[model samples]
Target: MTSRNPWSRPVGRRSVLVGTALGATALLAGSQLRFAGRSRAEGADPWAGWQPPVQSFPNTFIEQNVPIPMDDGVTIRADVWYPADESGAKVPGRYPVVVTTHCYGKALLGAMADYSRYGYVVVVADSRGTGASEGSFGLLDDREGADAYAIVEWAGTQPFSTGKVGVDGFSYLGATAAKTAATRPPHLAAANFGGAPTDPYRTFITQGGNWSSSSALWFALELLGVAPLPFTLNSYGGLDVQPRNPTTDIATFLTRLQTDGSSIPYRFAELQRLIDGSNNFDNGFWQERTTDVGNIDVPTLVYSGWADLFLRDTPRDFRALPLERGSKLMAIGPWTHYSLPKHIGSRNDQPIDDLLISWFDRWLKGIDNGVDRLDPVLLWENGSERWAGHDDWPVAGTSYDRLHLTGTRSGTSNSLNDGTLTALPAATAGSDTEVIDPLAGVCSRQTVQYLGGLPVYLPIAFFMPEFPISEFPGIDQIAPCFRTDDRANEQGALTWTTAPTGTDLLFTGPVALTLHGSTTAADPVWVARLSDVAPDGTARPIGEGALVASRRALDPARTKYSPDGDVVEPFHIHTHEAVLPVPRDAVETYNVEIWPTSWRVTAGHRLRLTIDGAEFPHLLPNASTPDRLGTLTVHYGPDRQSFLNLPVHQGAFP
Candidate 1:
């Protein structure tokens, strides 16, 4: 959560209060006294006061509501900020312009002011229907994309703007940058997206077809805070103070009355109801908002935390863009939702602002900052060393080795065995059954600290290794145990391991499982997580994916897989929603697609896979009935055709 009061220190009044209060009162005391003080303080401008130093470069700053003309002649209002000096200077035809869209929050002028100081024209506009912009905002949908595209074009034509334009921001803003870039706007040149969600349904609204209560609540509250209405005195006093007309500014009034201590939950609940009522993915609403990556044509930089709520969507969108149109760069850091400046292990390295400066220098200024020479994939390695840059993600020269499950009981020695190579039937039938009680669902060992004593929940066992340590310490703490659990009866978790490799294996792209299994429920959702198990028994989660049983038909067009032609389709995994019913006492095996990840598993580190009926918090707890018996069988060997397909690429630079 963002802290509103940045200067409230202990033991005294805030800096702003003490400084401003004393300065004002002292000025009234006597001009002679003030002059004396000023005379003693050499080279200090009395009028400057406590304001921050001016930026080094020539800068122009202004906050104005721009009337952006749309295709239908409907003018959309945008909040624009740019270097003031560029206004009348007839210097060049091209200047780099940065366009940013607000997330759930309305356009914040202060947020974009910093960008203008960096010598670029910055535009922050509310997605149509949001803030002061005309039209209705429909979450992540087409209207927003169109408005973004229009804004990009508008920025390009501005007299002060250089034809070159770039987009940058975090979360909702990040997603907007990507969607707009995909539109292939004429002036669009580059994009940098951080923690952007691509597939909203699968990654944001619902994880594995189940609602995320915490995330949903947070989003709702933010929306309410920014709703375009005003609160009245009667409204604050619990009176029936309805606005005279439908267009009353109730949102503004409500915001004004928000005190230091307010019932945030109450406001959040109101937004939650709006979200809960909408669950259909195929609804025309979501379809209209979704972006078509096929149109994206530019250089792109994507950054996401391994433990980010939108982890899956960030990389998914990056990979979706056609390679021919844009060059893709990905950086997976160890961070949680809000911790930006802090790195893993509590280290405060360079701030995010530094990264942005370097990126802008390369894209906007056309400066050879070595950004073009940098590796396409840059990730932090835990044990071996510090952050490493690779020519391409998931370095080449990796092997696909399988470790079969040979155990029996849920956690007993009988159920535990070394997953070594062995001959098995092509289509064997066996089953293990477990019940998922929603009330007693698995809790994530990690929690995201939020304001007002609220905490974000994560899944317990299903961890992703690629997630950064700082953003998600809880998952990082429990990740190691997920692989080497010799303990007995550890819920319904199933483990499969591979022998340590002798050399580094760079496996990139989506991970898939072609299992043949069936359950009794008509609609069953299965979750799969892949991990890297170190020799010391630490399990690092790398990738995770889920499939709703009924929608088992993989979309052959978007799938990627291992050597044995094991289908690893992306689009078909959760693109469509359908319910598949399981017959009584039936045995079925359905292929499951896990989210894509890129990591180099060094020699002596084991590769692991875990299959569970439920991945709590991250996904909704499965509600499997006792009478419904669900069993999963695996078939391996050259004849049975079991292998993982990885998208391997050689280094772009030597």
Candidate 2:
């Protein structure tokens, strides 16, 4: 539900006069001088009397529905907001323009007004097939990019425009801005992208071919909220447990429900069809939507949240952009999908707004605002509530240290050092194994309030509270982990270790796994989790990575790995999906790549790595079956050295 504004009613002329008087006093006191400036050519500030701060401006909010004609002759409906005084007295030749593309919910009048108050001619348009726009909304498609370009060009020619265009928004809007930048529209000068998904297959919808359960649920809710009339929960079954009435439109609601799994039969039909249609990582679909970061020559500011679902994608975009432009800046904070203006950490509410103003000042007004001289990247590190600027991301001067595992066992004599990564090894033959019951779904740590009775599900909610999965009390009832004091127990889980570091270490980038063992089945799935063990014997989950074995082939163009026979390699596996087989009792090593993360394991914190068969919530439970990875007989040794390889950055910022 949206927040209510008690002061939303129109103010009388007397009230407006009083408000203007107060604003004038503040301007005279030099509080809003930064925003009051004279036109370069005229040498006289047109807005000198309008010295009201952005927050207190007497905005004449007007929402006009206009049919924006695209190149294809398709007209998209846009809700345009401009100062009501535009047609009144003579104003500056033209005003700077900012365009916003709506998310899955389409454009709203209230949201559009919020941007118009910022002193720009704001245009909010419904993507094709959404809201009042023509054509079918096929999620993210080429048509939307084309439409954005058309809108920018149209805005540039309008009488009220200064011919400078800037685009801003999050998620889909962010992606649109990225795509528009790549297109290199003549009028598009700058952009602000937040929580944008760089690679659809790698970051959005599915990661490593595994569909995000939370994302799926969110899309389902969107469908329910937007569908037109007669909202029915009958087909959704238990979904009705939560009631939501967002819109009276039946078509919008039905469209949303059509995206859910419960209506799969009538919506998607064959499971393989849905998967094949969305398996666009290597296909032409994603290729068309993918942005050419190297081609985005315009100034850009990218924002992301540490806790955001699209955190990974935002960083990827920042790293991929061309450095020569020197125009790219990144701002990340501790926040989730919905929380903006306020964050869990850092104090930079004005960073987004200030960045926009400075960007426009330099690009549109040709004023030197020192924006180009700002640091290339700014990130918010957790535990520290301040912003840190760097010449590049993944901070320079990082090094990698391998932690080797060593222990004795109770299970099979697979005691060949098992070469797995770990601070120590198991000591027994019978280690720990947990059978996860899918019926009792795991609870997540992340939650969000919405129009529906239910709360939004987040990935953070499923993190294990303690180390040694066996120690988790909640798992005992649904899934149990095998336990043994024996450090050599190599039956259920694989253990790896690194030598204790005499000095502190900082590492960033992707983590990898190289396994040298065979399983009884042709297809197998394994999971690897990296953690830090404190001297106090407490363990905390730092970073975790997993991959479905069927998709093990590495994309040579994007893969990075160490040359040492250690074999922990990084590969972008989106190019292909291959089936790998293991002969029974045969030692065949498999190199696995995990997700990326940044961390500094202090001198006293032992870098502990855990190799397990499953990770609940984050990943689906690995049910051992003849059809799956087959009966597994795992082994590890230095000759077949299986370890975690980390990318260490080093060097000073320019």
Q: Top model by lDDT, which number?
A: 1
The whole-model lDDT of each prediction reads 0.50, 0.49
List ranges where model 2 is wrong by over 4 Å. 1-60, 83-93, 108-114, 221-281, 341-362, 365-370, 383-386, 405-504, 520-522, 562-569, 575-591, 620-634, 648-654
Candidate 1's displacement at residue 149, Å, is 2.0
- TM-score of decoy 1: 0.68
Candidate 2: 10-residue stretch with minimal lDDT: 1-10
Hey, what RMSD does candidate 2 come out at? 17.3
Clashes of each: 46, 61
Query: TM-scores of the models, in the given order?
Result: 0.68, 0.68
lDDT by residue (tens digit), candidate 1, 1-654:
001111112222233445345444543562111111101121222112111222434544444456787786645655555554545332233357888876443333223125565667777776655554554445667767787889999998898788888888776777788788888899988888877766665566555555454355456545642455332112111222222221422332243345321224434553554344344343454555566665777878778765566777666665555663215666666554544342421132444554565566676777665555555555554333345555443332322222333332212112223233111222432334444333222433212311111242233214543344334433333332222342222245555555566776555444556664545555556666666667776565566666666556555445443322334444454443444455644655566656555566777766666555654454433233232224434444333444343332211100
Candidate 1's clash total is: 46
Model 1, residue 465: what's the lDDT? 31
lDDT of 2 by residue, 1-654 (tens): 000111122243134444445444643573321112111221222112111123322343434346788877777656565654443322234577877765443432122124444456777776665554555554556777888888888877788788888877776677777777777789998777887775655556554544444345445543421322222221111122113233423343355345542332322332243344344235666666667666787778887755455666676677777755357777666445544232311234332455555555566656665666655655554322345555565444333324433343312223233332442222232222222122211222211211111232222225532234322212221211111122222234454444344555545445566654455555455556555545554444444555555556665445532222233334555544444444454656556656555555656555555555444444432222233434444453434434455644321110
